[model samples]
Target: MTSHADQPNVARTLTGQSGGEIPRDDWSAGRGRLFLLLVAPSVLLLVLLNAYPVFYAALQSVRNGTLISPGEFVGLSNFAKVLQSPDFWHSVRFTAIFTVSGVAGSWLIGMALALLLRAGVYGGGTVKVLLLLPWVVPIVVSSMAWNWLVATPDSPMPTLARMLGFETPLFLADPLLAAITVCVFKVWCSFPFMMLIMSAALSGIDRSVYEAASIDGATGWQRLRYITLPLTARTTYISWILMTIFCVNDFPTIYLLTAGGPIDATTSLIVLAYRLVFQNFQTGPGVAIALMMTAAMVVVSLILFRQIRKSGGPA
Candidate 1:
């Protein structure tokens, strides 16, 4: 549709010579305005909902005495108390175990499932749905269900143990056993999320790489080590970081199930904070403990994200 005179003009070309009117990019300003308009409410809401609470918590942590009717500001006294508490250290130790075990177990199982799904086994879709069901259920409901299955001697597992010539297992009764049970329960509930993310990472790998590795006589374990592991290293690290946060901050899984006991054996930092604030009515130390957890989370997340930046792809 161009005229012959216009066709000969260099300004009409994509290179934008000065012989004709240049196209205006007016949308850039409009887009910036629109973006701010759309994002402002969310930013405001985060400030109100998230940032305000954190700031308030920090303020509360420095204040002495109860939740309401604040006493004199005692800088770092609450944190010093929390740091010196034996119960706090116990909670921290168990929390570390629970986080490490739950993250490792879930990631290994999830990555295995992702690999199986990527290999396109029979009924993969159905299996994926079934695997997702545990995570899809409400935590309260799942925790209650697990309690029924394992918390009592009359439960199915204990009954089965009796039949197998073993004593009725007290999953939540003994300290060591309770720790193991809570960690396993957390893994069971958390693995489906890991599976979902790992599946996405697995799909992005080029099949040609694996084929070439196979032709070069790479064994199954070698391919897994040199190709799959290296490729998905970043994703694995990210998954571990997220799951650690979930496991550390978890309250319902421990409270609803064990209430941080078999004599306080399963108390995590979150549960300890709740017990201090609500049960013991020590708001200052409680908030200080919570802030400590937040600091730990920020440190861990930054380290993991740095690793991700260093890696080029899924790895």
Candidate 2:
């Protein structure tokens, strides 16, 4: 019904090539520009706040500096000194123990709680809120409460030990006991986060899959092993990576609980770095330690990221 000239114009309009509407290519370009405009401020802020400090720290790591002034350039000597220090190695060992215990213990407890909650236990909402209180409470307040419960021979834990006919256990005085206490405290404070993560991942799974497994005569443990775990593998790896970083970078947890004390038995790398920078005024070595920690974290993250990819990518 249309004439030849009119048909061409109509076709152009349909394809968004007419003067009244933007062409597809132009529209795409415009959208991209708008996205960049919206994201530019956040990008700039990240570069300023995170990137700049990391760059500055990298430079400082190569120089023998202090809080007062940037001292002589020392190349990698600071790193070498840190690596050779017995105290540094001691802290590294303790950090390894702390991180492993925190991650594994919290994950196990959280998974169990998540499964229990998923079963629609009575008063689940209230129970979940109660479980979350440890994480929700201010760390400072929690630390103080823990300190009061274990800091002295007259403390509640020690009193309980006495009543049980055992010697007064020095929870924060003995090096080994202090280390154990800190690691356990880290687990207590962190498990709620893992619970929330695992809960969400479990919720995403299809209920029909479990029903089918049960119909096929699969046991509860078998279904969990084969179906629940595999389906949540991506989320599990992500949580591990996040918790690893959190454990590595955690400063206040150990500091407030033990102050790296009795003999620095609970000192993590972050605590060691703090001592080096502020207490010892060895800025270069401190920053070098931090950089080494960052490198190690990157390696761990990449390994877990590969696991996530194997588990069908991110959740």
Query: TM-score for all predictions?
Result: 0.89, 0.94
Per-residue lDDT tens digits for candidate 2, residues 146-227, read 9999999999999999999999999999999999999999999999999999999999999999999999999999999999
- At residue 175, give the lDDT of candidate 1: 91
- Identify the candidate with maximal lDDT: 2
Q: Cα lDDT for residue 171, model 1?
A: 90
| Segments in model 2 whose C-alpha atoms lie over 4 Å from true places | 1-21
Supply candidate 2's per-residue lDDT for 162. 100
lDDT string, candidate 1, 270-311, tens digits: 999998888887889999999999899989888888888787
lDDT for model 1, please: 0.89
Provide the RMSD of all predictions against the true structure, rounded to 1 decimal.
Answer: 3.8, 2.6
Which stretch of 10 consecutive residues in model 1 shows the poorest summed lDDT?
8-17
Residue 245 shift from truth in candidate 2, angstroms: 0.7
